[model samples]
Target: MDNRAIGRCLLFLGDVTEPGFAKTAFGLRDWARERCVGELRLPQATVSAGLPQLTCEQAAAQGASALVIGVAAPGGGIPDAWVPALAAALDAGLDIVSGMHVRLDALPALREAAARSGRRLVDVRTPPADIPIATGLPRSGRRILTVGTDCALGKKYTALALSRGLAARGADVSFRATGQTGIMIAGSGMPIDAVVSDFVAGAAEILSPAAAPGHVDVIEGQGSLFHPAFAGVSLGLLHGSQPDMFVVCHDPRRDHLLGYPASPLPSIETVIAQTIALGRVTNPAIHCVGVALNTGGMDAAVAEAEIAAYAARLPYPVADPMRGGPAFERLLDACQETS
Candidate 1:
């Protein structure tokens, strides 16, 4: 999506209790809050963006230009009840932006509303029609993917931090956003989860192509290999990115899948092994570089202690990029090592 096309936006939240699925709202709040004017929450939604709650009409009056469906809805399909609410936003002169699997144009309500209001229907999830299949050929340069034990556990944040850290060290590098929220925050990226199942890996290949031998691409990873709901996307991204090194990201507080409570989250060691075994299909030399813990709201001392505990046990660097210090510096140092 064109970055210029987006203006002050009003995010629409589905009844997603878990932060993992509703990352779009939270990511924008943390990264691009200026662009997020307000939020329209469904009655059933238990979570909040902590922004001024407003209706589409009220948001439009305040100069909101777009209504973003900010939740990764279960099954990726738009619920029938959301159609009318979305149409109302379009009717209020706000363009509709969604990264859901369903195309906004496909819904008659939204299609007709946009026609009447002369607004755009932006679907970031749709891939280009001419995308080629993944070749699995070795590419130049180096790549580091921030994989995780489950969804929304800091993969994108870790990748972004690493990219900035690498650039600060005078390395040629870029952040490759893969998921919907990451795509929105980066302003442009391949929606790896939205691609047709057969072309998912192909989409990833195009997302981060070959670069100079000295260049590094800090690729934001997708779902976990252990998540039954999104493991396919995770595997596709791993095979396509073909990273020389990967960081295992995890939220120590989470023990089970966000939505599927019965399914336990995989251990960091398990994730590291699974990533290597599966990623070998495209990049045989792939291995773990570090571990990034998501200690978002943890107390400073607690977070530091957690990092220290992990570092003492794991053979690799362990740190929270948000809680940057000597430990995080160590992780960045490991990531930049090409030899």
Candidate 2:
């Protein structure tokens, strides 16, 4: 489904300016702005308590026909404070789109509110009904997986950029999203992390097939191999996608894992090596094709210097897709050579 068909306008409820939990909201805002999918209406003012609060009428006045619960809170559950605002938005006749594990439809009040307002409740993390267990069978055509040095290191962004860049160069490319935000953008994809552990790989396998044959499937990578809590999902995605080539995504400034401040981030070389080794468990010839650097907090000079350093260290092409240089072309060229 086209992303534009999802909603006319969206009001992101959470503050994306916050430090850690802003990745999803920021990605959605960037994607929406780039595609002209309708305006993203942020709150003009905050409550005295500093939380974002807006009535449904105010949201409509701001041209928001839908309310997106964009904050990825701790434990993936909705905050108690957000309940009232969400209910108000629902009563105001705005559809609710949420990526949180807590489904709005599951809540008695929100369900009744939607019913009363005739609004739709969209749960982005809802798993598909027909996902089968992964057979680990060999799939045809070329596939590329984006592996990351840490969680939220721009893996999905790199995958999307690669898909668009490759398609622009006349390549038949398809992006397979493994997370909620990517699912929201692509309109169709399995939320791999939400699935039961037993079916995680199976979910990836089931989502691998392209609309037509011979397309390069650019499967989005999830949690890092180093993330203590989510490493299993990452491995499942790697094996399930059975990619022929892989791109390593990293943020040079991130010295430690996102939430685990004590766990230091591994080197780029270590990340690439681990990804290749783990990927080979399902596909023996899996290789790192390129490196995607996330320079989100870095200056122009620092980002460029970091990219140059990565290029010097790694044999593969290194680029920051967000900065938009020759990285896409170089990545596509590398993929073509590998294919």
**Leading candidate by lDDT:** 1
- Per-residue lDDT tens digits for candidate 1, residues 1-339, read 464247789999867676667878888787778889899987888889899999988898888999988888778888887888888888888998888887889988888999999999988777767778889998998999989999878998899889888889899998888877777777788888778889888888888898999999999998889999899999989998999999999998998997798999888889888999999999989989999999999899999888888888889999999888898899999997766
**Model 2 residue 282 CA deviation in Å:** 2.2
**Predicted structure 1, TM vs. truth:** 0.89
In candidate 2, which residue ranges exceed 4 Å CA deviation?
Answer: 1-5, 15-17, 34-65, 210-213
**Clash number for every model?**
0, 0
TM-score for each model: 0.89, 0.88
Could you list the CA RMSD of all candidates, in the order they appear? Answer: 2.6, 3.6
| Candidate 1 wrong stretches, greater than 4 Å | 1-5, 14-21, 42-46, 54-63, 260-263
lDDT of candidate 2 over 190-283, digit per residue (tens): 8889898888888988888634556799999999888999999999999899999999998888899987999999888898888888888889
Total backbone collisions, model 2: 0
